[model samples]
Target: MKFADYYEIMQTIARYGHALDAGTAPFDQIFTDNVELDLTHAGPPGQPGPVIKGRQHVLEAMTGSADDPHTYRSVLTRPALSHHTTNSEIVADRGDEVEVRSKFLRLGNSQPGPMPILIGQYLDTLIRTIDGWRISRREVISHGP
Candidate 1:
């Protein structure tokens, strides 16, 4: 991959957290039309999480709607909540497609101090589009709640 491609890919990954935190995630910029978000391992321990499909559904899940209550809007709207990413590695690059593995940390500050709410790794498959690199699939593996 070219240097510019690598940088753009990293920026796209970082944008996910920033947009979500801002509550103005541009789903089209971050994900493909048929995106698959596998949160099967992102829920509380011993519970089966959801595997959201399609960009529109993903938007509803993240932003919430009157008809859809299973959303991350609650946690995202928390004043003290923030998302951080580190250790991004491009595991594969085939010009038009790439795979990235990265670590994510969710933190919350309240009362006395800030604390980690969740730690996990993101396995993402991104495809090049006319707009730029967009994630086609994202499988989140949680290490802790």
Candidate 2:
């Protein structure tokens, strides 16, 4: 991949963390309309994660439910949440698309300071569109049991 492609891909990944931290939805700028979000590896020790398809569904998943406000599903609604990414590897590089594997450390502010929340891996496939790189599919895998 060219330097620009690599940089842009990383930027795309960075944007995810920033968006979450800011609690903003830049859907069209970050994902494709037919995006698939697979959180099968993000559930409890052995529980199955929810697999959400379509952009609107993914948006709803991120927005989460108001009734159960403290659940992981409502993480986006929490304040002072941070996501840091590292070990971004380009798994495949096509002319117009690329696959990336990366690790993230999620932290949340506590009375003492920032506390580790979850360590996870992001498996993403991004495509170059008129607007720039947009994630078409994303699978989140948690490192914690």
Candidate 3:
């Protein structure tokens, strides 16, 4: 792929953050039907843990968890410490698909609490379907409590 297209792909990957800024649902739309998030890699969030599958499942994870006062407020708006910060791995082509990995980090803090740092990677598999480049798989690995 040319440099321009490569940049475009990276931008699309980063766009997930932009949409999260404007969206109430954090990551549902960012993932595809076949996508699955293995949050166990970072342990669970207790009841209604955020590990989810498919776009709808991920959507519910974001929306449903927002019922808790703490979680709701934490996510209703973007965390103060986190913005759109990401570093992408070299994009590799796999026939009609592209394999991409990116390191993501964000910071968040709450009243009467210590400011926490969040870091993660988006392991993505994008495919060039009839609709053009679309995320076919996504795995989120986070380093945070």
Candidate 4:
């Protein structure tokens, strides 16, 4: 793939981080309409999380609505900083389709401590659309503290 394409993909990942930190609902822009989000590996030990289908479902999970009681609004509103570092490697680049394996480190400083709250890796599948490159599938693998 061209460097521009690579940079664009990287930017998309960066945007994902920004949205999460800001608690903004940018799912529709970042992911495809029928995106598949697999967070099973990120679940607690002995329990597997369900694979979420559709952009709307993923958006709700990421940014809960005002009417949702179990949303992560409290956490997102904290006076903390979140950083998402991605080391992405392009596995395949077939013109309109791209697959990337990215090692991600998500750090959150919500308290007066020098530690992170979450860390994970993402296996992403992206497709080039009329708007731009959007993620179609993302498999999250968690590495806990």
Candidate 5:
């Protein structure tokens, strides 16, 4: 694969973190319309969350609950002071599609001091679309302390 293609894929990963942190980018722009999101591993033990299908549902989940004011306020304010890092490796490059395995880390000042809130690995499948590289599937596997 061309270096530019790899760079674009990296940018897409960065955009995912940026969108989550800022809540500024629309889900459709970063992910495919029929994206499959597996965040089950992020849930409690023996209680993996359901595999979310479609972009709208995924967007809603990531944006937090609108019915609860606390959840809404927390999502909007918490990540603003955080830093995100995505250490990604291109595991497969098929010209039109690419698979990346990434280590994701988030550090924020939500507690006494800046500390890690999450450490995880993302298995991402990206497709080269007319708009650019967009994530088609994402499986989040979180690391426990």
Candidate 6:
């Protein structure tokens, strides 16, 4: 019900997005000690899947170099894809903590013949710690059929 709180949440979301966009692992300041992420991503085994429990686990699932040899070799993994969030709907509120549902799109990756275009929504639970607001649990739902 407060504009300041709304702005803070928005900023927090933007920071997370920027971290991923810059292809850098998000610092520990944005996690709730036990951050959980259910990523609907793949990268040919020993590379990707659902990572829960720690932010480090999520980082391994996401962090990579655009100039990496393997990525450069893979036709499907080239050209790259970026994610954008929209239609954020705040579903639950607990004072400084809340849960939001939003639609996300993986835009513009031309490589990977059959791009696993991610067009889906996420249910993210966020909390405000002593540092700031952080993602507590985020459940991903990828579209199919």
- The prediction achieving the highest lDDT against the true structure is 1
How would the candidate models be sorted by lDDT, starting from the highest? 1, 2, 4, 5, 6, 3
Clash pairs detected, candidate 4: none
Q: TM-scores of the models, in the given order?
A: 0.89, 0.86, 0.68, 0.84, 0.84, 0.72
For model 3, give the 10-residue run with minimal summed lDDT. Answer: 66-75
Cα lDDT tens digits, model 4, 92-133, are 989988998887766656456746766778999999988889
For model 2, the superposed segments whose C-alpha errors exceed 4 Å read 65-75
- Please provide, for model 1 over 7-60, each residue's C-alpha lDDT reduced to its tens digit, 9 standing for 90 to 100: 889999998888767766667788998999999998778886899999888787
lDDT head-to-head 1 vs 3, winner? 1
Clashes of each: 0, 0, 0, 0, 0, 1
lDDT of each: 0.85, 0.81, 0.59, 0.76, 0.75, 0.62
TM-score of 4: 0.84
- Cα deviation in Å at residue 26, candidate 2? 0.9
For model 5, residues 69-127, the per-residue Cα lDDT tens digits are 11233353364355365668999989899999998877767447777767888999999
> For model 3, how many clashes?
0
Model 4: residue 29 alpha-carbon error in angstroms: 2.2
TM-score-better candidate, 1 vs 3: 1
TM-score pick, better of 3 and 4: 4
lDDT of 5 at 75: 52
What's the CA RMSD for each of the models? 3.2, 4.3, 5.4, 3.5, 3.9, 6.2
Q: 1-145 in candidate 3: lDDT tens per residue?
A: 7675576567668766566554543342345556676565544355233556676655456445533212233243454645454778757786667888888765567786635466767788876655445566766676664
Q: Using lDDT as the measure, name the better of candidate 1 and candidate 4.
A: 1
Which runs in model 6 stand beyond 4 Å of their true positions? Answer: 40-51, 64-78, 111-116
